[model samples]
Every structure is written in structure tokens, then in C-alpha cells.
Target: MTARPILLAAALLLGACSDAPSPHDLSEEAEYFEVSDNSNNTVPVAISLRPIKLDLEIPRHHLASIAHPYKPWAKTIWDRVNLQVLLPDFQFRNTQNLAEFNSQDSADVLRYRIGGLSSDQSFVLLSVNKEYQEVDDFADVHLRAYVNRRKYGNQSEESIQARQPTMFVVNESYLRTPSEKPIVLSCNLRRCNASMVIPASNWPEADRVDFGGTQGVRIEFNYDQKYLRQWQQIHNFVLATIASYIHYPESVL
Candidate 1:
């Protein structure tokens, strides 16, 4: 009777307003696709990019309702999140201007991503922080969202195309620190362990070394196990983007 697979425990967050792109700067035209390796053999790592922006101060009572005492798989992944169909495309800032938008992106920051596997004319820039981090517990919401390559790269596409490694990470926790441990990603085969209840806030100066150029090496996959369904679709898209501001009704701006 083996069918159980209701695994859960993850997080995401953000904020800001009237930059004009509130509608999450809708975009489309990311054609070129190739991320089907199903692991078993395939690894190539060395990803890094620079471009940081974070202004999270979601204290609307910490958008409660995701409480977990014994882990009902995080309230069954927060009742299969829907977030009014995912926070109006992404982009925020209203909690009274979130302290002037985190003092204009510097009062503190911490963003992340570092998954790998890319080659043959690369181009992958993905973003998923529309907003969802008014923390109270989603395990304190941590992030380092990508980077998992056992070994394998330089897939000779023959004819100049070298620079394949998808890296992503942003840290600027000058305060609300949290992460004694709980940001695991273990599971190359199965036994399930796709946890991310926010708990890895390590922004050690972003471990520099970005010879800049390339806007932001975002995508290009082959991490394995179908990249754990992209870590459970980014943990149910940040639990339906914090359940769309915890069932917003009185205003979450």
C-alpha cells in the first residue's frame, strides 16, 4: 500500500510598492527549453550571478494559519495553497511603505538561488518572489533556493558556448536572523527530504567572485529526480504566496 507522498515544509517572502511593476512585471518569451535529465547520470556545476533586491517586512500578524505542532505536512501544505491564483503576478510594498521599502533596498536583505546544470547556448533567468514572507513560523522562512549538481559539465555543444553553471543566493539579514538548521535538500533517490521551512539565512557577503555580465544566469536544469518537481513547485509556490497574504480581505498592502 505504498502511495504516501504528501511531503511538505517550505517558504518564500517579499515586499515593495508602486514601482509600477506591481503586477509582478509580467513577462513571457523564455523559449529555449531543455531540462529533462531525470538524473541517474548527469551533473555540471559552477553557477553565480549578481543582482540583489529584498524588502521583506510582512508582519500582518505573521500571516498566521500555517501553524504546525506535529506537522500535518504543514497543514497539508496549507490546504493545497491557491493564493487567489498566486499574488497578482508578483511584486509588493505597502505595509506602510515597508519602512520606506527597507530603506531603499539596504536596510537589510537576503535572497537566494543556486541550482546547476547548463551548457549548449545557455539562457535561463527565473524569478519567483512575487511576495510571501510575513513570517511567524513557516520555519522562520530561510532561502538558498538552488544548486544541486553531483558532477558533470562541459557538454560539448561544439562551436563556442562555455559558461554553464546556475547559481543563486542573496543574503542581507542585518537583523531578523533565523536558521539554527532546517534547510535540507537531501534525496537523490528517494526517502523524501525536500524541506525548506525557511532556515538557512547565510549571506556571508554572498561569497563574491562575479565577473559580471549576463543579466543573471537564472535557469537551465538537470538536477535529478525531476529536480524534485522543482522542489515541490517551489513549495507550492511559497504556499500559495503565504495563502495570498493569509486570505487577504482587510488589505495586505
Candidate 2:
């Protein structure tokens, strides 16, 4: 009677919940390194983003005690180990925006959440500059890009903007805000023009060496083919991971 229908309704609701992709669900199935708490919330050990969907598998760094340099089984099991992204080398430069270090408790500095977006329709990334000596030897590099709206659905736009924090990679010359005794990363001192914006497609192919940029309000940065390839890969990987991690920390990593 009425009781029977009530039980059936409950069953249907349970089925619906089971069918939907949970936030903890990942697009792929592989060796999963899960970290969860009593709340049962688990952050993904890796993340993927963009057209390339770069894999962001973390390797457990606890193995530092092992004297063995290489182990096949260890390589297979822990090759791409899972560890927290300690301090991101990339961020945005807007407000008091020119932050230059990896320290906590700095609200002005962008938080290292898995997914952060911007009003300019761009995503921020952390990378390295091997070509330019100014940033090459520097610990990390920040890359910013506006995401094409058509790609991500409209319904997700609000979350994408508000939740996704804008990342900044500031010039080292800025005043170092001393929080927890924060220090700016010192790089090889070399003079380079910051006025020009070098298009990635027009970059020349070369070894690990960074080029100069135009100095102005709208500055341009360019990377030759060698560095371009790496930039593209890392960019895609970090972005994709951010997208997924922000949405579902448990599933992506």
C-alpha cells in the first residue's frame, strides 16, 4: 500500500545518487593514493586540465630514506608518487599583487587551491623558465591564460570565477612583505627588456635560454620552441588538474 510505495521511492532516490558522478569520482582508474580524514573527505593525489589533460600524479617523497637510487617495483608502484603541492611557484599579480615567495598566512598572496580562475577568462599556472636566466634559475614561474568560455558550460561559470583564485607571479624587485620572515627568490641578475610581448607561436627554436620582454603596462613574454614545448605541457597539466581538483579533490588526485 502506501508503505510499499514509500519504500520504492527511497530505493529510486538511492539509485539516482549512485548513478551520478560523485565529487570523489575520477575520470580514470589507476593506482590511487588516497589521503582522507575522519570526515571522509579525500583530496585527489593528482589533477588534469585543458586539451592535453596533463597527468599530475604525485610521488610519495617519504622514500628519501631509501639509499637505493632505482628500484623496478618501487618505480612501478611509486614512480609517480603522490605528495602535496607544497608551495606553488606560480601566482597572479594584480592588487597588492606582487607577492614573491611560498609562505602561508598571506591573504594578499593567492591560495594554492587546485582550481582557480579569473574574470579575464584566464587560468593561472606555475612553471619554470629555463631559457631566460632572469627567471630560469628562479625557483618557479607563473603563467596566466584566459579560459575560453565556450569550453566550460555556462552553469559552472560562477563557481569558476568566485572559487578559482587568481594566481600571480610577481617580479622579484617588489618589496618583500616579511611574513614568517618571507624572502623573495633571488635570480641571476641580468638586464632584459620587458616591453615586448613575444608570441609563443612565433618563438624561435633553441636550447634552454630565456628571452627578454617589453617593458610597459602591457608587457609581452616569449619562449623559444624548446621552452615552448615544456611550457605547453606543464601549462596544460596544471590547468587541467586545477579544474578537476577544484571540482572534486578526491577524484582527480
Candidate 3:
């Protein structure tokens, strides 16, 4: 994922706190941690950098027993950030297993996977990070960097000129946003790419948004190219659904 390196670097720069609460203490809040292997005394902890609550209603059967093996920390982050609820063609299933932790930067990093349950190879990989300052500047700098790399990266002048027409470029006006800035995205004919967070090549079209000001939350998600037309709707649904789950304490507000 393109966002991994950036997230890791940011996390390293921020660093983890030595006095952070233990897994046992945090587990008392049943909604956050999942206890899977009692025999081995292995407890997967769910750490949140922000003082927010997740309010998702998931069916008991749909809740995953085992977390996705990638992060090895938590079973599931958000129960189901489902796209099917907004569109029928999107038969995606979320493998609730993922990891959450606080970086030294006082930011929380969350990674999870949602993919097609049946035959289609459609999926959305999402990453959420808490920032101390405005995230727009962070996203803009990376978006510009991606554009420059594609335009001027290691290539002959002739080859670069030849591919100029097909090269991806930023499309700031593609989506309308009344409250916040339009997500930063660059698109060619085949696929689109976002800055800061890069989705796997298999899931090409991507976009990211910063819930600016004190909200301090930045979200990036990438999905298959087939759903490119529904990018705006998909973006809105994802943002709204996730935002609904996050409730900030009065002090943070």
C-alpha cells in the first residue's frame, strides 16, 4: 500500500508513549479489544489515538471471530463499512480483523480490508490517521509529489512526452463538496490515484479526504476501477458512515 511508508514514517516521527495504558486495562471496554485465545492467554488490543467512540450495529454472525492476519492486534476496527448498503452491485465483505495503535506522533493508525465475498475481485482498503494539524496540507504536498514523479520520473524525454497525454494528473474539480475541499485525486483513462495513501495496484481508483479543522481525522480508501463512476457517492457514503461512528468527547470538541 502506498500509504504504508508514509504512515510508518509519520508514526515513527510521532513515536509511541511509554506510559500508555496496558492491554488488560483497555480490554475492560469490551467494544474495543477482542479475546480470542484464552488457552494461550493471548489478548489482542485495540488502541485508539483519538477520544472517540465507535457506534456500529453489526450482526453477531457477521462479526468476525478471527482478525485479519495483517496487523495482528485487533479483530475488527469498524464492524462493516459496507458499500452494498449504498449499491447492490458492490458485494463486498469486510474481514473485521485489523490492527490499531498510537504512534509517537500522538496519531492513531488504523488499517483494514474489505473485499468481494463471491467471484468479483472488488475490494476497498481503508486507512485512518489522526493528525495534530490540518491534514489538507499533508495531502496536497503528497498529491503534487505523485504528479511530479509520474511526469518527470526516470524516463527519456521522448518517452515522457509521448506518454504525457495518458499520464495521470490531479482532478480537483471532479467531485463537488459543499462543506469541505474535494478529495485529492489524479486519474488517467484506466485508473485514478490519491496522494499520501496508495492502494494496491489491483484496486486502482483511490481518493482521500481530511475532515479539516479540529476534527483531526484523515481517511483514505481505494477500490476497484469498475466503480469509478460512483466515486462521489462512494466517497460520501464512506465518509458519512465512518463519521457517524466517531463521537468526540466534549473536551476535544
RMSD of each: 23.6, 23.1, 15.9
Stretches > 4 Å off in candidate 1: 1-78, 84-154, 157-161, 172-253
Residue 210, candidate 3: Cα error in Å is 19
lDDT of each: 0.25, 0.24, 0.29
Worst 10 residues of 1 by lDDT: 76-85
Scored against the true structure, residue 71 in model 1 reaches a CA lDDT of 13
lDDT tens string, model 1, 1-253? 1211211122322233333332223322221212233441123211111122212223222221111111121111111110111122222333333453235333121112221111112212333232111121112233233322222466453422232212322222421112222223433332223322221122223521221211221211122333333443444454344323322122111
For model 3, the superposed segments whose C-alpha errors exceed 4 Å read: 1-13, 18-50, 59-88, 94-154, 162-179, 186-214, 240-253
Residue range with the least summed lDDT across 10 consecutive positions in model 2:
3-12
Residue 113 of candidate 2: its Cα lDDT?
22
Higher-TM-score candidate of 2 and 3: 3
- The best-first sequence of candidates by lDDT reads 3, 1, 2
Better of 1 and 3 by TM-score: 3
CA lDDT, candidate 2, residue 118: 13
TM for candidate 2 is 0.17
What's the lDDT for residue 64 in model 1?
16
- Predicted candidate 3 versus true structure: per-residue lDDT over 1-253, tens digit per residue: 1321111111212233455554444432323223242332222222232212322333222223322121113211222222122132322222232221212221122122222111111122223222111123223322221212133457785664343211122234554322223344434544443322112221212211111112222243444334444555555555554443333221110
